[model samples]
Target: MRLSGKRASQLALNAFIVLLLAMSIYPMTILLFGFTKDSLTWQYNQWLPALPMWFTNLNYAWKQVGTAFWNTLFVAAAATLGGVFLSSLGGFVFSRMKFYAKEIIFYFIIALMMVPAILGLIPWYLLIKELGLLNSLWALVFTSVFGAPIFGIFLLRGFFSSIPEELFEAAKIDGCGNFKLYYKIAVPVSLSSLATLAIMQVMGVWNDLVGPSIVLTSPDKFVITLALRNFSMSMSGGGMLTNYPALFAAYVISSIPLVLLFFFASKYYIEGLTSSGMKL
Candidate 1:
């Protein structure tokens, strides 16, 4: 069938979008090629070449990569879990409860969010040092945990507020206590928001380098970001080829979990954002 002019224009627009997506992904695809290419010169060459791909050297990358991957995973998982629990609980309380100083306390918390992270970094480091948490994963985890969940709480509180008060009143009539109302009613109702928050927390903590760089000095405790920095340094020092392909391969590996999680939870994530009056 012959296309109308408008339909043809739409088809052209769609083709442009497809081309843009491919362009964005091309560098990453090329990096995968670089990872397997044995010769440094070949890997550095701008044009693609005809060569048989090899997986044998993956073991070499895997050796250090595996340990770093696990360390990062552990930190991200622990931080996300802890952050979700605390932020969700705080959100629930702020949404539901009324206390004499609650508003003041929350205002203070929100104020802290406005403070630049650099301004607090020195104090935070000093506190961590006093607690003897340096050179430990807990140092990073604890620091992240204390970082005010103003945004998380604010997002979740809006979501919780949007929930009908009638549901909680009905639950109370059924002899449900505060804990039961929260666990049975609020939690189930706000799962979408919670899932969104969890995804954000995971992505933030997983990709974080600054906190770990400051707190974790031990090689064994290094997260993927720290490990990547070390790898880059080693390459710079002539210990290894500064293979862009290998660096990109490591980045791709690190990014996969967060990407997959976001894809699967995309609907809920979008819903949560929209419901919470957030743009993205």
Candidate 2:
């Protein structure tokens, strides 16, 4: 059948997109398949386990990676919660409250984002050590610190600004104080933006490796990425790949929290991010 040029172009674009998507996910797909196998069969070009091997691999991977998984989750959750709350408050102030030097303060805060993160890492590590936080999850938490997260204040400020001033005035007239308004009114209404920020912070903290690797010296305190690297290195040591399927299984297991988090929060996340862009 003869096809129009535009239709052909659309078909070509769709095929390219699907191809790219497959390429992007192919490695993870292999890792996920390894979760179903009790052995490192990907080396032999085998993708799926023959049958009933999932339980054994999962158990092995859990025994190896469980502590790291929980540690990562704790750090991610702590950083996200604290950063979101503080950034929301900062956003509220920058957006709704008329305060002196607000613009200057905000611009300075945003300026920190321009300084390459790599440049700050040395000082950050030194600071962590000075505080005697080396080899602790507290170091990891403190590194992610409770401040306006990169772009978080901007997101929330813009969102808060978009909320009608009349709402604030109405709350004031109803005998609501500023704190009450923030707690009862602003927070409830800003859940979408907050959720978006929370998801980003969680992903960033969960995947973080270099910072934790530098700050955390103990094997047990390692976050997921550090733990994965350690596990892989140990397995590959002495040219003998030992139980590497269990490592792949760990990758699969480690990814589950973020996957489930996004699965649930995706609706609000998409709305918050896209709405901000549209408004801008």
Q: Which candidate should be chosen as best, given TM-score against the real structure?
A: 2
Give lDDT tens digits, candidate 1, residues 64-169: 5667788878877787788887887888889998879988888877777667888878887888889998888888776666552767787777778888999999
TM-score of candidate 2 versus the correct structure, residues matched by position:
0.89
Native-to-model Cα distance after best TM-score fit, residue 233 in candidate 2, in Å: 0.6
Candidate 1: 10-residue stretch with minimal lDDT: 41-50
Please write out the lDDT profile of model 2 over residues 200-261, one tens digit for every residue.
88888987888987888877888898888887787775454467567777888898997899
Candidate-wise lDDT, in order: 0.76, 0.81
Clashing residue pairs in candidate 2 are none
Quote the positional error of residue 78 for candidate 2 in Å: 1.1
Q: Please report, as a residue range, the 10-residue window in candidate 2 with the lowest summed lDDT.
A: 40-49
Report how far residue 97 has shifted in candidate 2, in Å: 0.6
Per-candidate TM vs. native? 0.87, 0.89
